[model samples]
Target: MKQDQDNCDFIIQAGHDIYYTHKNVLSAGCDYFEAMLKYDTKESREGKVVFKDVDSECVKNCIDFIYSGEIEIPNEKMNDLLYAAIMMQLEDVKQAVSDILKRSITVENYFSTRKVADIYGLDAVSTRCRVFFSKNLMKISMQPGFGNIEKTDILNFVKSEKSGLYEEAKLTLSLRWVENNRKNEEHLHKCLEVIKFDKMSPAFLEHLLESNLIISNDFGLYKLFNGHLLKASKRLGKAKGEIDNRDFIILFDADTDCIRSLDPIAEKVEKFHDEKFKHLRDFGTISLDSYIYVPCENKSVHRLDCRSKNSKWEKMKDMICDHGEFPRSVSWSGLIFVIGGSCHKATNDVETFTYSLNQWSQLQNKPTAICDASLVSLDDSIYCIGGIGQDGVEVSSFCRFIPFSAEWVDLEPMRYPVSDMGVVAVDQKIFVLGGCSGGIEVNYVSCYDVISAQWTSLSSMIACRSFVSAHHMGNWIYAVAYGKVSNVIEKYDFSKDKWIIVKPEVDQCFTIYESTFVKL
Candidate 1:
């Protein structure tokens, strides 16, 4: 083969039969290939060589780069390409890769990149990774992948002089790490040694000692923790003035299937992916005993544990019988009440599900058949709002069911005939949002006082829409419609007695929706 050889050459195979060539163009640019071709080696003489270890995709890209002086390294594959370039001693590709990696360091992947760079002797890239980690350890430690990182790698950073962290954050992060990785209990002490307990506040150290993490078979480590706690607890009082963790625990039917939560401070929406129940078309949801109970289609009820670390939506026993479509529900004294919501002739059916017994029973029916109405429970009674009857007449009457007396107590009805109304309970008062009346959307907002047995008309919502979901947080009421520009999420202020648009509303979605407020 000559300098300008026009002959088939080396084959680089990977993952079965995938192969690429190291031709004249590659030999000129790559020192390894150049050496093989120049020294009268077997590859030079035979005009055919095979690299069994070369990655097929990577070698193909290298060949393209050697010939065209251009190649792309995707973010996910940059490390692989860097390794290939260094092995082949391709100066240009190696330099290009190192520069991009050094400049593109992120908290999420800096530790991983640092590990790889250290092995490859990429000092500049390694330095950037170390710098990023040291500068942002507090924030980086809170990242999603931090708890899953290997203990050895984290210890390596902790041992570094450049790791500019005080012992306070280290204590918190270590506890969080163990909380997230309970399976890694064997590595607890090894990880805890990195946190400087001597520098932590006495109150914080006492809190740390109170944590059940010290309950280990390693008696020596346990004694050492208690030794620190004995001295710390004697010197300090109960911890105070820490960051306030009070938060709203929101539970709402996002769609017909899944439930969602809204964090006012975090301003984030988290969906209960496992809680989705297909064909769910009713607005029946209640929070009781730290679980969210929802009624779905096919007469099936599902529950999601609000207090569980690993919560899942589980199907409960079907109702004793169908309360019919759109049956309203409320939870009180460990019992769930499902009532009202039907088509054709209105039916006066009421079903109650007992949480402790895991059984369903019939409750006293409403004074009259109520369909498409709303139910809200306050104390020992369940209040049923307006609905339409089989005679094609809108019901202006409202009633409350007293569980203790096992009797129906009629309450003053809304000023206007209402159906498909949005009802939410706040304190001793119940507020109803906009709904449809006589097949037409109405924007009438009404509030009923339970103690006074009175109905008070408040400010109306921004739009007239039926099938609305309302959530109560503190003194605010959030109303979201399932029909029409559902994008507008409105909030009702009890103090101001007015409705305020929450700006950028929730995403548009249909299906019977429900909402509950959780204050933490």
Candidate 2:
């Protein structure tokens, strides 16, 4: 039976609204109400309570939950309900509200929810938000509310192992945040302390010094970043933060089904991810984040997680059309583009795959039906370099592809006709290394400047062999001649136009035929 307002002994006033209830009903569920009603307080003698800090709707919901043991918790009123439950000492109601808030937390509402959790000292909610924040740091950092996050939370995220940010990225993000608040020099210093300055490369540190954000507004960081650059260049032995800071040249030999790791800085090669797989001939590989995608000639794609210790080749969605053998691939905007390869004969088939959706779709064919071409992504478009054209001849053909518009525009041809060459892009320039110019192997090297729209011939490699694989790391371009049994590895310094031999320093040599080399 419903009690009339006149018969109710307790009166609760929330803002302009009044809630009529009984002492027995209020005290049975709320400790705060029971203590007030039992004690000699003025509110107890008058049998009334006035709440100015809580919302009227939240107060009504809490009281309704007390009488009926159930209430609907709306998303918009979640924070108010939680605060009201806390004020009334409703343990069960508070727990239910907290669970609902945690369940509904997302990248968009994380900052607001975190503020509420911090206000109430909600450790569980705070911890869950931290975990969620770390996973989506890249995405959340771009949000408008990210700049308003507290300095302490930013530092904690910088220290998290799974933040998915490299040392350079972390430094840039911290500096960017500090740039927003120049008066907080103390906070900026604290943020700089947690970063592993030794892990940053000299080039990145120098680039940081050139940043107007640091040089113009914050001269103190300029000096600190400069000092770190000096220290980083002279630091002996391997750098710290091995998980996120280190870069390796991943060499996968499809013919022998063997994978090897080459530490570019140390010039050392080891079998770190040497797991053997079924023979994958003429497969193409591309590196994205921590995973490597291998599009096989068997029309299937496999992924390898570099972060996993027991990482095995995981099969992903198969291709919509048979990419066939010698398909060149590049990743842009989180999508994989597989260019022309050989089918019955040379085909200009093109396909794209989305890793998240686990689906593949066909794209417009290339202008020229080419196979064994070198594809590199830079700026916002992909460039397809030298390969064997439809006439079954080595070509100097060069073209630019815009994935956003699915448009292909022909650019200036290479300086020399080559196929199965080592090609890599760095600093808005593409370097083409040793490959076959005709039936005979050539050690010719060329550079194509995207900004200048011109080509320049550079110093040739020491080893004159075909089937070359190239990777760029830091300031060096490594070209591996895998056609011969020697497996000659040479690195080029574009600034000096010089090439030097790099020994593998491994116990066993790799049988590197039709291999893909990627920097991770």
Candidate 3:
């Protein structure tokens, strides 16, 4: 069949007799013809077959590849070759044509080629085009063909974890894309899923509240955003107990650098420092009454009693054993647990102090050296979220320590790695917030489910937030909004699954050494 092409016994015809080829030869290389010719049908018995609606030239090129494993794909006939190859299931020919087309992609043709790639299931080509679309996102999106991108493709691109567009730019362009195809406006919500709700400018969030596009469609997001924008400007609404006590909130008032007391019920902040303690930093606690602090200088323990008559910062006894580190501390069940910080070098040593005995004792060591990890105490356990791993790399690892067993068990990690994050526990589940480094960042929000042993991502923050400190009051969670564009109180309602920005009536902006929830 290969050597005697001119005297071939079988004849295959297609497209108005525009082309003809050998029967067995075409069947060997083409999946469609192989099964068709296996039977004693008229075409098989008579050694002839025909195909309509296929370009004669594309058919000939495919036949050439069958005989010699070589074919030239012209740019003009590229789509024709693609369609014919798919119809005949000529994988090798299809692959060769796809490779050539993929290499020839440009900003001018990315959208069109991507359409073809997707329709024909050319995944490799499709992947390449999507990446190209993401990298040159803004420039290519303004092109005419950008309007032709399918709604699913648009959703996938906006939420792409690899997308490098700035939050503001991404939202702006994406919203415009939505407006262009307003008939399919429901896809807008899906597009909104990947956007950083916290990263948007306060002014923009205000603007969104008034948009028919949002208010009429995104019911939950719209309602919560309206509440926040109103509160930021000192507008009080009838929504009571929605942002009330979780019992507590952590605050770092710009007017006072010391950690301040947050009054959730009255929506007020109170003085946190007395004469002897004008400054406090790097502290932790799980108990509502008093927090345990391991000072760095003398390495002494200090206590602030909310119920004490004097209510002054009192220095407790020095650590029983000098670990040579002032690690972050958290108190639970009248006991304080210390973990992570430099003890000459990064260490994972664990120690506990008893409130009754007032003595410190060593506990089981942690799995790895971690400093600057986000710590949250709940459910008789301490959750140690994202931190530096053994080799000093930012990690997405999550681990929990059971106080009774003095053992650390690893949990599923957050979707993104973060440092200087805020963790709040409400109802045995923990929510973790944002971190930024260098020039790139993620306004990521995710939660760990104790029951499911799974990590679920929540909506992103309003804007880029870093070094945020947060606490919970009932079902509502609040975090410090600290970025160049945002410095306010950001509230999140679990039921609403939306973020609200509240501006404190502070005289001026303030920074803090540390912030944590304390009952006063």
Candidate 4:
């Protein structure tokens, strides 16, 4: 085919060069050439085709593929060849180019290839590149070529839900982009708009404001950040429970006097203050705002600010009543509520601690005297699930308490009477996980729809766990193990109706017994 250039009947012009090719061979492989040659098009009449925007080498590659069924493409020429194939409507050539591009995607060249795939609308190649990009965002962002990525790609990535980066990480990436490019206000605004400032920590927001990056360059961004900071301050407590803040579960290990923070996503564990809480057992733990409050049996409370790198347990005011012996606690409306448990015996005593007030107030006692009950707050009320009643027998009784009116209302009973069950509320549904039923552990998982006032059974967990701390973060319910199964953590997937165990990297078994799991 290369030697038959002298007898060629067609001429192809591309970017300062012309190629000789047979018209019959051109029409045989490419639909674009066949249609043009079969019709009264100017190209057919003139016996010539022109692709002014395409490079000569790309045109040569396409022509070579038309004659030989294949063409060798360099990593640097894949984009241009793909473009030429798209223009020539060569489906096979496009597929081949896309495959090469997919295989060529690397951390260093991701931005460049992603840009080409996105521009040419190559879904297969784009999807693969995006997956690679999401998985290696940190590494890709640090590359020297990161600053050269298109603004559109950056904005799309920043707005993507599957970017696999935390809000702060996204913010850092955006700032780095702006710093590298020295972008104008219009571009800077788009970058700032996608970042979830409301989700970032107050300390990070403060640091961002002090940094010369934003403060020195853009006034509009500074004002916008200030507004976000103000709103964040107003809703700081609630923000601490947001999805970004739920990256780690902080557990107060009473036996070892250590605070263990476990990152379920990262599967890593780190311990702090190994000897801090010596003999700190039988305490009700609740996290509000960014602080973890441990209410001791002696009515004294110790608060730890999780924001600090070296945060220590600071003493707070004593509780008004004795909230001792496996008392159930929940944080609602920025207040810590410790419900019924035994001080001397099973008592209906209830107390709520206001962090802002630093004072504990006794509330009306619960109607039923119970201990080891699962307490979860939903909407404007608190639900106290099954537990052992004062008669020393486990009951399936369910009740709701309205804090505003201070009234307790009895509700539908659970299918099985259970105690020490992991219970948590997400939206209008409450999930009651494995617990003890008649002195035996049950892997039963039940969900109660508050709106319908009905209980429905879901898939059972792989392992039975009692005294599990079930936490609702993102879309899954994490049941942190207790008793002999302390090393296991089961995650409930709502969509799949299944439970999967999560293993964290820890040097020792999680001694989660009598330990509190607070999503931080």
Candidate 5:
């Protein structure tokens, strides 16, 4: 026994043996002790446990068990090792044994066994295990207790069978916490907590009504149950005021041949939002040949008017300096900046028309001339993205126009070149949606980040459209009409990151050339 101990110590000191064994062990079971002893042997024990027979291999194995509390086992010998670890109640060894089994198990089989492993408090082992366990898991529709789980997570959970959740996660996840877990009757009774309603969906309002938590006295007006009518009524109203006293200007393309009245259109808008229209009585409209600006009293929109076609020509020449035609896509920064359009029979000349002192003045030319592109004003700067060029080819280059310095700087291009696309500014971010690229209508939505100077693709819209018109209202971006004739209006909510299909209350026959939204 003394010679055997010396041999074991010699193997450990040689670094070949990395484990150790204990002497005078507890008499829990001989099977465990025998397995532990075998675990300590580097060679096949052959059911022998005598000190005289223990060679260098046995000394190495004993040293391995002493230091690491683990013995490397072959694939074929894992089952026996697991059984021994379980019998010995060695949690760390059992976990190691489970890990070995998991590494070999197929993804499909791993899922099924993971649950069994989890139930036994072996979550650490089970978590590292991945299996196609979802296939065998039964799918059940259970309303998620709406206690603050993220919508994306809920949606993913509901779509997977791993959880016995429902497929309506998109619908239920957007609800408030009080509405989700209705079992807490006391919490539900605290309904008078008059919170400001920033986003109000028709479906959400309907859900509240169906749940008996709210009642509507009139269409589009909602009141919470056991709450004051005044507070509920105020919360449900839309259009607060005329954007304070600041001059709110609207820019629109009047499509040369279209016959439309700016005031009646404004009045019609007021009728749809009766509660908010009361404050718009002081608003005015300025109509140009094909462009109109609301609160027409704004001096910026008036300065661009050229009086006659020849005067417009002289104005164009004086403003552009290169004697080019007007650009189809225009953006306002106190003055109008025009880029590549039909110049001298489809010429590419980027020019700026300054509105200060009521005169057209030229600015720095664009790096590349583009037409039918989407233009947006964000943070006192203008961005031009994706359009057809003078060569009748589509381009995706992005350019910025600085008003104060009168300079043009090139920026990173878009992922796709889209012409005749609708662009809208929402929350200081520009969204370019639905346009003709590669001679085909595209439904891809791209968002440009001013801060990061990067472009990210968003969820595609329901329909493919080009020449679309987009308007931003609060957290929603409403896109309406495209192609030959479309009455479809799609509303995209950034908060929910979901699209809502809505029918505009206005007449369907009227073609909307340019519509402005005023949050009254």
Candidate 6:
């Protein structure tokens, strides 16, 4: 066999044999049908002619079609070429013939082309052929057989100018089908499979409260799909022992500046929750004085002892580095880790004040300089959420600090960049709320799922707020004192997933900046 580079022609040489290629021996155009008889034995012609001889020009055309895998047949010869290509299993030639038929088919020839493509098992070509014949093709196209078109092919056709079938095709495909093709389809399905019931049954609402899916807004209501209203209700009527006992700790910024200023706001907190605290005296600024202190300013975290009367607040004998800024955001385990704050122009350095050693020590530095970011402890790790960086630039990305290893790992950035946001860890998930760095204040809430390493958008708060503080109690997360000198308080119910308004009894305006919460 001799192959032609530029044309679909092959020259075959057999010893003392001359025959022409054709589809069948008796085909009308195959004049070279007798050529095969000269080379074959008499017995070969006795049964049936599998091959036939055609006109010389037609033979050359077919040969060229076979070699090149493409042939531009005129409108009149299109049917003949298609039949020949299909018989010879010339896939490319068959496709080319289909393309021609698709572009030139009229009502008169539509059925014919459809029948030919269907017989040849060319589904794509058959669809195109059927579309040409039927005026209401979209209505019939969804009927079983057409559902198998490759998604990529459908998308491509929709993108093409010649194909005005996007709307029709889109109607046939459901959102579920589109979702099924996603790379994270299994994960999405798993999330949807878990049913959350509103009425209390065998499952506890606390389980839903623990879910990262529940969101609470500024209005103090937990929110689910379509803003399902959630209200605070004591666990009753079912398995009462399953309810867990957890206390609420309100964080207040009690730095020397806030305390010494003789602000009426500090007086109000002491008066309101006096019964809940064992000791209310200023514990001095633990963070700023030790880790985030400036050269001359006295910034410290006041330790408000909340334990029982017999239990005294143990001083983690930790000494501040000489001239080092006091720690702003501190987390306690074996030691206290303080993140970024203004020491000398807002240092991004991280330091640990070991409760055992009672001395502040330097740890790894953050990738970016930040201050006023919210820090929360979850799964024995400390996470620093949105804050303002150098030049007052707001950042949404977060970094985690591991106490055992003393390493910091970066996590996914938040959907919105904000500073002075309030964050609380509940059920191994991080709930971040109101904060602002630039002129824009954000009320949108977001939750970070630790296991999945993904973020989900939650309902927005009723009021835009900044510099908020959050406290988690039972299955509820409360956001208090957002914005400058505001007494706005909201509670989020994790069970029904809704926010409800709550009144915080406080007199005078105060900003809760870099505050810490301890469960009472």
lDDT of each: 0.65, 0.73, 0.63, 0.74, 0.45, 0.48
Model 1 misplaced regions, further than 4 Å: 1-258, 265-267, 272-275, 279-283, 343-345, 483-486, 504-514, 518-520
- TM-scores for all candidates: the values are 0.49, 0.53, 0.47, 0.53, 0.40, 0.42
Candidate 6 residue-wise lDDT, 417-451, digit = tens: 88766788877689998888465877878999999
Number of the top-ranking candidate, with lDDT as the measure:
4
* Displacement of the residue 180 alpha carbon in candidate 4, Å: 51
* Better model by lDDT: candidate 2 vs candidate 5: 2
Model 2, 1-520: lDDT tens digits are 1235877898899999888898887787778888999888999899888999899999888889989999878888888888898888888887887887788787668888899998987888888898887666544543446667688878886786666667756765565565445554467777778888887656456544643344545667677777887886565224443333367777665445667777878777676565675555557677764577878788888887765447778889888766577567876544578888743246688877655446576766787788777788775578888887778888889999865456799999987788777788887788888878876889988888888999998888887967677887788888876643245778888679898888767666566554444432
Better of 1 and 5 by lDDT: 1
Predicted structure 1, TM vs. truth: 0.49
Q: Where is model 5 more than 4 Å wrong at Cα?
A: 1-326, 329-333, 342-348, 354-356, 482-486, 516-520
Q: Model 4 has how many clashing residue pairs?
A: 0
RMSD of 4: 22.8
lDDT for each residue of candidate 5 in 270-347, tens digit (9 for 90 to 100): 122111111222222222222232221111222222111121211222333332222344444223454554322233
lDDT of 6: 0.48
Q: What TM-score would candidate 4 get against the native? A: 0.53
Candidate 3 per-residue lDDT over residues 1-520, each given as its tens digit:
2434576767656666533467667678777888878787887887776768888788777877788888878889999998988887888888888888779888667777987887888999988987787666554544555555678867776676565555545565565565445554666667767776554434344444533353547778577667655554342223232222123455544444444555666666555444234444333333422342434434577775533334556677665433333356665433467677532235687776654335566666787887667677775478888765556567677888876456689877777666657787776578888764332455788888888888888997886676677777666788764532125567897777898776555444565444566532
Report the CA-based lDDT of candidate 4 relative to the real structure: 0.74
Q: Tell me how candidate 1 scores on lDDT.
A: 0.65
Off by over 4 Å in 2: 1-245, 253-257, 342-344, 483-486, 514-520
Root-mean-square deviation of each candidate, in angstroms?
Answer: 21.4, 12.7, 20.6, 22.8, 20.7, 21.7
Error of 2 at 405 (Å): 1.2
Report, for all candidates in order, the number of backbone clashes. Answer: 1, 0, 12, 0, 17, 38
